[model samples]
Target chain A: MWSATDPRFGFWLPLALLCLATGFWLTDRKDSRKRLASVTLFASLALIVFFGANTRGGDTSETALLAVLLHMLGPVALMAIGSLIATFSGPTPVGPLPRGLRPLGFSMAIGGLIWIGLMLIEEPPDAIANGIGETIWGAWVEVFLSILILVATLAGAFCIMMGDERHKEAFTLTILTISAGLMFFEIMHNGSDGLEATGWYQIHWQQMVFLIGGLLGIILAFIAFIALVYMAERRAPDPDVVAPLTEEEKSVVDAVLRLNLELEEVEE
Target chain B: MSEKKDAWWGPIALLMLLIAFSMNLFVWQLSGGVEFSSIIDRMVTGFSLAFGITSFALLFVSLGAVHKHMRWQEQILGLFGCAYLGIKCYGWVGNGFDSISEDAVILLAGLTAMLAAVGLVFGLLLALVTGREHIPDLLLEMDSTDGDVAVELED
Candidate 1:
């Protein structure tokens, strides 16, 4: 039972509507699932954000089912989002999804609904963990996070390095290698701690790594900027150099054209 | 490199940003600020992450820029990916794996397996129901776009 007047709902309703509106505006007839996913996501966000993590509203027994479903909202919204990303990054949206993927998708979507059912069985108060199948299912977060880190660093490298020459990549690679080497200095390294370490709570090595990473990012931006400028400037050929062609060169060009046209006509 | 019809990812990311911002704004008045903030923040962080995820997904799967060939497979995979993250949320929260009872955990696994059978049943039913012609296209899409189709009839 959603309370339309739950003060918090006041804040969330409008925001959810905004998401719906934005999704509507951004999408068209073809990508209806995207719009549906977007709207569902926003609506789920409203439920999660406005109601807080406590899905029960006020009562414990009354909102139990709602709470369980609410728990599912975040997961569904996340799936919808992930779906959007998959759609975005994959082969240009086509007539149908790639062949092997459909089975996986069906299983996954059904799996999600199953997950929701499982969550409903004995809705745990905690946002995650403590559910019926906490171990296998719960570990999904860290798995994806680890994978995300790998993807980010690699894709970021490609996104920045694309269209550049081999030497440029070699240079960046060399710099990165050197950066890793510097970590051996111990002074340049931070005593490794998990994400639990606060910003100020971190040791000197962490700050060093942070500073170095930041510097490299800025440096990469500058390099990209320089490359763009050079590319723009180099778009035109040198003006002071060879004019059209010397008469002797012109004769060569005329002969080449004649031969090419003869070849074309013969081929035709 | 594959070219995109439009930078659709940009707007999607922007929308994620907006959602993230809105989440922050909503929790501006809270008691356990850190935990609540982190929960929403974790979800919002996916905005910047869209690039990496999309990049990775694109590496293996091929989805067109427009609504050209998007079908149930894509719909499920994306939906499944979302559903899959539910496990992740669980893994990260609380004492994580440490707090769980090993025996009880097995039950959870069985529960999922049993429920997966149920999911398959439901999926089959849905396929049958939505297979009807009167039903509109259910693929995630907007009302109108460049890809919209026009039909002609011959008398």
Candidate 2:
């Protein structure tokens, strides 16, 4: 009973085409299959754009699209590009990025962060239906505050433990910790536009639980994997003992060692 | 040396306990100075949802790995597993298919992916900055036993 004319078909069609394209692209190594994948990908994208433009309420679709691109994609893309440049433009360049570009990279990265901060404060897309902008800004604030608290706490603890030499650092960290903690309390009490204080508190606790659970799960999984590997290795029989190296093998080893030692000496 | 290390354990344990107790008290006070039941329920729900999402994502990834092996039976099973998990994710989000708008669902997925990407990028950037980009090589070096290295040198 499903037909192309169905209202939902527009959404489903592009998704199906995308999935098909991905499958072909991943599974096939041949050129023809790659061509087919490219074609399907383009077709899916074209369909998505066409349907997006022709939605029941065209203005809403356009607004949503603008909001997503501006609020979500733009900042992310800027951050990623900026971070990549900055990372590779260091004194020890990771790739082809010139060290001379470090300043530019830093500017871009900071610009991206400022954009995000401005978006949070301004709530430019808050008028969008479903309050997507508010939700995103709330999530960002929670994460930012969490990170600030965590970093400040850890740094404060470390500085305090480092004896008199780091007393100033410890004092600064304590101030930062207190400030972050206060900010967290303030946000939880006052809440944001579409969400109440109680709701914010609920979300904060939920996220804490989620974060703790995730960390524990990852740690446990890693421990389990390591234990399993150890057990499997233990079950394996020991390798047969090998005879001592022959004169030729010894000579070869000595030659390689000598070459390495000579190279080390030269480098020194 | 061992004794010195052991000497720190008592203090560390006491510190941890103190922190935990203080946190518990804080949470109790925050929960309207009421009984702990509501806070516990919230925590339980959060933990369950976290584990559920993690388990489903892991299952999907493992199934994708199976599919890559190109075994028909396993691939078919993986397809079914993926479909079931996809349905479960939808249910978790909206209770049913019709309850959530298509655009909202898409936005949620997109946001999740974007956040994950951001985390990944930052992590990689940290690694680069910390000169840990040769971690793969370090792991390979760790995996090579002394005897194996000797044998390789001889060969």
Candidate 3:
């Protein structure tokens, strides 16, 4: 029977797909095929992040799901933002052939490292009630770490947007989507209370609606990304094969070629 | 090219900044025990800003690609279709989020609907993203380029 503690699709599905998506991505060689695999991996990771947020962590006062989710926000936000920043502002490719893949690899490596480190910390999962009961200092530690990660992530995004043109649109979009999802989550979480006070409470449905909506937003964004990549890859060969006169066509073709080059640049 | 290469990170960094900003904002609320409405307002604004920008990015990327492929008119049509779907999905999600009242049936129904929607969206997006290239006939056309359009089949 379904209950409040019922496992979320957010948690299970993303984890399961993570394996499949990564496998496919790693196995695929064709540019188009690789793109599809990468997108799948990206989408799965995002979903994992979303669902992870709802699970409890090894601390107390909130559901373990929620705490774990919160815990994840720290590392993910930090790395994502850091990676983005590195994308635009970091040291120029020093010893690399294709520069783009290096940053991606570096970021992935860092993420894996952090995950391992956190596990080694052996932090026990804590419920909300436990968190509330903990001493002020303990709470402060959590808050401080969380803040540090948040700051790093935001800074990464800001630097990237302000400095580079290629990824500005992508960074802007990701930031916006995350912000929107947060707002929806917070609003519905609180609005139910207000409605209850007014004697017209309808909370359960609200959660469902908001979560579903957020998920859809995530899916659409993923689709848009895939389309962008496909278009870029597909348009790559035209400039090499066909001669064009119009400056506009040249520029468009150049853009496509650049993207193709970037894709090819990824090391592994 | 250096600048272009570096530019992609801007959004990701900004996302981190926002997360920090929002967390601090929330911490301020929790620490001070501020009124719920204030927190809600902040949260809403944050969500709007984040999601709105994301939507814009999605639109830009999608449109850019579509314009490259189909005519401008077709690109616009495609954009419109995506937007329509997004809006419709938003409404459905909003309804589910808001439907969690004391009514057991409504709650149950809402949960089911939300789960289904999330799964559908997640699964479809995954499949589409991983299989997007296969969706286009462009590559198939290009296969001949290797054998060369110069190869006149004696058929």
Candidate 4:
């Protein structure tokens, strides 16, 4: 009953195809299969752009496209970039990040948090169309920020507990955590013009339930997988017995050992 | 001892924060008149949905990746588990299928998958960068052989 022209179809089908294509492209062993995946990926992307631009200016489709782009670029991208920079530039830099980049990373992370605040307080993308509603977006932000805040708080606490001169790092984390917590509280009690307080609260409750459930699921799956591996290993048969080395084999081994010893002596 | 005493405050601070948040939630619930049963129902639904999806994905992926190395018994068990998980997921999601529009579900699933993929990529990159040196050692540990087994002959 659905047509390609339907906005929902236009948006969702291509997105699903894109995801499938990407997964296949990543995992496929054959070059031909990879080529097929690549073609699918490009086609799906083209379809999305075509459908998005097919509508006239100010239409729901166009608005939806713009909103989706904004959501991707605004908070999601910014947070990822910020976190990467912060991790590499922190006091205990994770990788080979330069110590000098610390300030820049710190600033970028703060900027990301500020952008999130602006999105929540001033300019929420509530006018999304094509069946993408505010509830989903709100629930996402709730879950994302809640996880960030909780993890940061716990990390900060642990850092402080180490008693190893990580106070400055802990302080920074605490500040970020508190700022995020404040933002969450603000949204919870005095919801912005885009969504009512009760609606936001409901979304938060549902998302919290989902998050907890997901965590539990991850733990259970991990345990189950480990058990399976353990059982399989236990049931594995012993190696087949083999004959001892022949004269030729022994000679070959002696030659290799003598060569290694000569090399070691020369090095010494 | 002084340092240890100082570290005690850190956990206490975390505990206080937890208590404060709990109290705030309790107050909100009291004011909001939200039913406890509804919360329980949602939690159960969430658990079933997440558990089923995660187990299925994990088992299916592992089976595919190591199919050649796995024994026939293991493969059969994994396939059976995957089927069971798939059925459970369908049952849970199907119960509320009508409530959620197909478009919304697709969109949510797509977004969640994208986010998870991105997170995984980032985590892997960080791990690669931080733990590059240990990788060769790990491989060697796996590949290293134990001493030769000795069989005694009956006289």
What CA RMSD would candidate 1 show? 25.4
Per-residue lDDT of model 2, residues A1-268, tens digit only: 8543333454545656665676556654643555677788898677666665554332343334434544556656665676667667765544657767766765665455455445433424443324443333444456554554455455555445544455544564455446545656665656544566665565445444434443444344344334444554565667789999999999999999999999999999
CAPRI-style class, candidate 3: incorrect
Q: Lowest summed-lDDT stretch of 10 residues in model 4 chain A? A: A56-65
Provide the lDDT at B2 for model 2: 69
CAPRI-style grade of the A/B interface in model 1? incorrect
TM-score of each: 0.24, 0.51, 0.22, 0.68
Q: Write the per-residue lDDT of candidate 1 for residues A158-264, one digit (tens) a residue.
A: 43344333343334333432332232121112211211212212211222222223233334333433443455445544557656788999999999999999999
lDDT of 1 at A188: 16
Q: Among these predicted structures, which one has the highest TM-score?
A: 4
Candidate 1 lDDT score at position B31: 19
Displacement of residue B45 (Cα, Å) in model 4 is 0.9
Categorize the docking of model 2. incorrect
Pairs in clash, predicted candidate 4:
none
Candidate number of the best DockQ: 4
**Candidate 3, position A11, lDDT:** 41
